[model samples]
Target: MPARRKDPAIPAGLKIMAPEPAVRLAKEAEIGGLGLDWSEQPEMLDDVGLAEWERLAGVFAHDATRFREGERAAITAYCSWWSAFATAAADVRDRGPVVEGRSDMDRGRLVKNPATVAMREASQQLRYWARELGLTTDARVRIGLADQGDDKNDDDNPFA
Candidate 1:
């Protein structure tokens, strides 16, 4: 039996989703600009597609805002890029269960693979962009995760 081939179109990062508002607003913006009904666009952003969408959303937000448009635009762009990259990484991580289930399957079983490697690469690229935006030497290094490590910072959590 031949090993089952994974679908090329179904990359590990495909499951990644952007922020909620991003998904809604970006699609609205895109469709409105195109003068097309939102539901009519079957190709309208799924979660993964929203990653790219948010980047443009950030651009729009920055441009429309009254403050330091240039600085805000750059900052928002960097954040959007990071979020997209992170979501992509998370998608790869989500594949773990599928891949594990294939362990005892026959050679012909289609194995779900992770795009962690690819996600990491994209993250690296985003990291560089973040650094450039922040004017930091180690944008990728010494990074922080979403979860706050200590209780003192627990207030930052929305649920708190």
Candidate 2:
């Protein structure tokens, strides 16, 4: 089997590396901006996508240092996926997940709705983008953006 894909190296800015080591590593793995304008929304995005972009942008603004201009495309992709997911989910909600099949053989049978499939695909893509952008709780913890605290709680047992 092929070797497993390696996780992307954490940017020097995200870690607590020493100044000397950080500077040395910078020469080999320097992270730079792409000069993209963040103020304007991408022309390709529709109204739903624009709203998603705005929502994500607002969340990212709180930790602007974590994200850079190089990640604009990733952010755009996340927004696009979110829009697609929202649209597909709405369709699936309006029309149930099971629908009458259009194929000749399955015409009378209730098959899965195309919108449900689209929603599933979009949801998967959204999850991937969320993890990539450190938008998920698990991603944030893994990327050192969140504190790793003990799991101790007053009601540890769910059935309690």
Candidate 3:
């Protein structure tokens, strides 16, 4: 098991939650900005999709206030993107990349299938969601996941 990190000591009258509960709450709560809780439960996703969602969720897990308020829409959007990305990626894997179809003018020649296009669009959205959710390298570094070149104690740096 990965080492369990202690929750940061909070001032009196404050509460904090671990990642898993924060994720569950974000998904299940009926938040106004998310528009009727379109987000799926973590149990609904396949392993890969679930992992991605959890990773994104963990970004805000430490900050209960952010997860509770501002991130609701973002979390739901990420879930929506995950569904699209997973479906498109799976279809491309199971079926060949090219989609076969008929042209508008004549039914004889098929216009290229839109599966590739859909996949590309979903991929782009997934990338955007990852960045927004702090899954990107720059985001991770800012959140203390990825190490910046300066390994020295940050307190020692006067600017910090």
In order, the Cα lDDT scores of the candidates are 0.50, 0.78, 0.63
| Tens-digit per-residue lDDT, 30-98, candidate 1 | 543322221222233455545544544554443342122234434444555555666766766766523
Clash totals for all candidate models: 0, 0, 1
- Report the Cα lDDT for candidate 1: 0.50
Give, for candidate 1, the lowest lDDT window spanning 10 residues.
Answer: 34-43
**Tens digit of per-residue lDDT, candidate 2, span 29-72:** 45645333457788888899999887766755655446666777
Please identify model 1 stretches exceeding 4 Å from their true place. 1-68, 97-114, 135-160
Q: TM-scores of all models?
A: 0.32, 0.68, 0.49
**lDDT, candidate 3, at 122:** 81
| Model 2 TM-score, all chains together | 0.68
CA shift at 95, candidate 1, in angstroms? 1.9
Which RMSD values do the candidates have, in order?
A: 23.8, 10.9, 13.2
What tens-digit string does per-residue lDDT give for candidate 3 at 1-160? 9998665675666766657965766665656233222234445556655666666556555544444444655666677777777777788778666555556664665455566688788889878876776767877776666444757778877888
